[model samples]
Target: MNIVCIAWGSLLWKPGPLKLASGWHPGGPLLPLEFARDSDDSEELALVLCPGAPLIPTYWAYVDAPDLDAARAMLAAREKIHPGHPEWIGSFPAVDGAAVQPEIAAWLRARGFDAVVWTALPPKIAGTEGRMPSPAEAVDFLAGLEGETREAARYYVRRTPAHIDTRYRRLIEARLGWRPLHEAAVTRMA
Candidate 1:
């Protein structure tokens, strides 16, 4: 069997050891992607696929699976999803390649890949010990960092793709009271 892992953020750049059966292709607007939720694993805000917000650019890659059951298990495990709370995983229809279509959920269900997993962390509802910070709080937190940590945060914002509008890289800069890195880079080059 084959499974598709829809990606729009860090996963596209760093898939780790996860095997891919296909190259990344434009996956149609299936869900909203953003860096809104605070990451329990890191000080930085993490990307989430949520219900609200406009559709954003996304990519998908295929993975070969032994079976549907194993595909679900492997995906959930790979995405670090809790088994008890399956809502963290959103399953949608598989597009033949990069093509976009509506009602993908129904299509996937018909094809027996209904349990295919995509990760989304909704606002609030502590996936960790405490409630994840809101986007505003995350901005404040990032602004308060010092030295290398601050530079690292700025670099992360600088490197991230701009299509991920919800990352609010400019908002982070303005909130931090700094100029945009791209502008600064341009100034340096001149």
Candidate 2:
């Protein structure tokens, strides 16, 4: 089955093997993107589209996969989501035929894709499991992190797609209270 995985956050840039086929294109329906989901691997809370939040033009990348099961397994492994775990990633369904977004569905159908699987955590459900931290709290959370985890978070924020000078990115930066990458470089030079 021809499959495509939807990436809206960290997967956008660091997709591992998910980006092997056809690379990725800027596509998918606009969703309410926010950094509300707490990460089990890192201190920084990751972004997720929640219901009842203000909708924004969120970007998605599509990666081609010939095997649906393999693709799902790879994604699950990368995300560290056990099959039956009920935290966040597990809740996402592997939809077929682009059912999540009508426009994307039409395009995929036209391309002769056999299946489309998208995994995203809706904010409402995320809240039920555990409350997303506030901006101030998130910033405070990042303050205690160091080394590779901190660097990874910084890289993720810099690569994520959003409107120029997006509030989401700004909030993350301001909350992190870290100097911009450029500034840090200049400071090191001085």
**C-alpha lDDT of residue 126 in model 1:** 35
Across 22-90, the per-residue lDDT of candidate 2 in tens digits comes to 545555445556666657666455767555445554333444545656666667666766566423332
Q: Model 1, range 9-91, lDDT digits (tens) per residue?
A: 55565555455666666643456655566555444555665546566766666766665455555666766667775555555
Cα-based RMSD of candidate 1: 7.5
- TM-score of model number 1: 0.66
Which residue pairs in candidate 1 collide?
93-104
Clashing pairs in 2: 50-123
Q: Return the TM-score for each candidate structure.
A: 0.66, 0.67
Model 2 whole-model lDDT (C-alpha atoms): 0.53
Q: Distance (Å) between predicted and true CA of 23, model 1?
A: 1.8
How many residue pairs clash in all the candidates, one count each?
A: 1, 1
Regions of candidate 2 where Cα sits further than 4 Å from its true position: 58-64, 86-113, 121-128, 164-168, 175-190
